[model samples]
Target: MTKAYFILILTSFVVAGCGTTQVKRGNLGKVIEPQESRLILSTKNIVSVGDVMLRAGEYSKEGIKLETETFNLKDSQTTSVKHKQHTFIFSIPSGEYLLYSQNNEGSYYASEQPFSGLKGTKDGYGGLFVPNGSPSATEFYWNWNKAPNVLFAHQAMLLTPINGSIGKTSSALKNKNASIPSATLTYAGVASAQVRFVYKEFTADGYARPAFTQEVSLDYKPGGTYAYKSALFKVYKADSTSINFEIINPLY
Candidate 1:
């Protein structure tokens, strides 16, 4: 059987009192995955603020199935899905598609490419504020017990760059939080060799937080490469300081 490698890059940022700081960071290089099989990415002390969970589901044109398992990176075994909101996870099947997400309150927060009706705007304090594509926002409470304000957004394409020719339909932000929107593209019938997982969260106080944006490139005949970009911003309360964060894959 052939061996597959999964690459993941986890980066985080915390902004307080008008200053930014980088906390607990590392990269999981090339995790081996068995061919014609499925593997879960696991880690220890990987998430500094909250628990890192994985949710998987098959992609279709109509919609996606929410009945998926939530796996913990700490343990390589299947776990329970505790969150009531839409759980985020990446399941690749050697194809291309557009990825997007929203906040619990039914707000469109993030996307791989620039999206209309959900762009960040400057607030009264000259801070850039962006809604989570929902009426209300959700919080991602890490192990530190710090409930970091969280938002959901996704990018389009599997292992290919989104070209301008694809037109406006190439990327879009959905209002409904649970609606998982994705698109599949063909690649010479060679099958996609790898899958990339990218996500970003922006606060309401002019601060952008980075969660995890990594690539899991599968090993197949004549292996291929993928590239993409993601951006998120946050706005702080009147008496609070805000920060912004941006995560770029391949960093090239």
Candidate 2:
């Protein structure tokens, strides 16, 4: 069958399923369809996290015109409240898409690892970790143990120190008490010494953040001049098994 004819038939299936089908967008800014196929382009930039843009090929009598479409990851204004920006609302149809350029800003905290949303050749639904803020903000206690020679240096946010317990924490510990060194006590006792570690409270802005971006190309047939710009995406295929993309871009 011809490309245009196939697209026509595919549109029917999409329209028929619209009533019952629900579209879900992920933090990486891509539409997630478990039993369907599509493509999305998004950035990790905090200012533009909710906005997604893609470079598409539009066939014209002169040549294939390059077009851009920007949309919010959210589907509705209500959902956009938390997301914050929604210039366009649109979806992507199933077809081969290509990633030509990718820039991954490293994670803010050394403990938190940064990731490029979609990687290599992948099929089916996927999620990308968008750094909204520090991985965590709440203060918690850890390294609960007893010390022999009680050398309690600091106090914990929760749970009072019983004897020689320390409440050293992971991230909060560093943020609050950078001057305090790990307690090195002289433990002479044998079978009854536990240590406790504490993590103090902190805010999300305590650490730095990362912003990533990637440029992708959608497959389109090379005909007519376009009148206006739109989020128009033709349904090229309907089979959920037909969608897949190869990552040819770097994440740096």
Candidate 3:
């Protein structure tokens, strides 16, 4: 049992506020069989991008019926809109569904706590004045019957537009603007697999102090959709330790 699990990618959570959605995935009635129910949307780019959200839903047990896809940049010769790489094909009825992404709203699709940054704000602005060494914001789980049955929710970003020099420190022009002025919104929540970080020692009734920690799951399987095949999560440490949460994704 060599499970360490100590990985913290952090810095991503300006969450839910881009505006726009017509709602479609067979209108959420869930029934798209392109060859045995498959839904994929996670370009797996690595870097260089912004403002591209694609969410789909259906996984009921009293939760997860999401629907969001609002990425626009139509061009008529030149208004500056070079956004391409969209592959969303869905076929449902096999049961269980939920997808997530919001690469521009800073990042999203948290699975029930552990995405601190809550858009971050303990005082002043943006969790310890954001800019690389992010201090907070990481609580994703935008509600999908509580989210995380996992069909997909892969967000990739690399927003760049740092135009505001000369005594510039308006907090880096507010962490982003002018189409993401100096930004970043990486996906894979927070990782370092290798057993990451897991420390448990029981026999309490003594000393204990823990703050800021979120991760309900992860180990790989961030592959592609149709509910991939693996990448699952479930880490509940209670007995008497004070660590009762962990739920990675994929596995549909």
lDDT of 2 at 251: 17
Over 130-193, each residue of candidate 2 has an lDDT whose tens digit, in order, gives 2233232111111113222222111112121111111122111112333231211111111122
| TM-score of each prediction | 0.13, 0.13, 0.13
Report, for every candidate in turn, its global Cα lDDT versus the true structure: 0.20, 0.21, 0.21
Per-residue lDDT for 172 in model 1? 22
- List residue ranges in candidate 2 displaced over 4 A: 1-10, 16-111, 119-169, 172-252
**Per-residue CA lDDT of candidate 3, range 149-221, in tens?**
3333222111221111111101111111122212111122224541132221112332222332222233533
**Global local distance difference test of model 3:** 0.21
Candidates ranked by lDDT, best first? 3, 2, 1
RMSD of each: 32.3, 35.7, 30.4
lDDT of 2 at 160: 19
Candidate 1, residue 250: CA error in Å? 24
- Tell me the tens digit of each residue's lDDT in model 1 across 1-252: 223222211122222322432222212112222122122211111111122112111112122122211111111111111222322222211111121222232212112211111122111100011133322212211121212222211222112211111111221212342232221111111125332233333343423355433323323322122333311111111111211111111110
Q: Give lDDT: candidate 3, residue 173.
A: 12
lDDT of 1 at 115: 18
Instruction: TM-score for candidate 2, please give it.
Output: 0.13
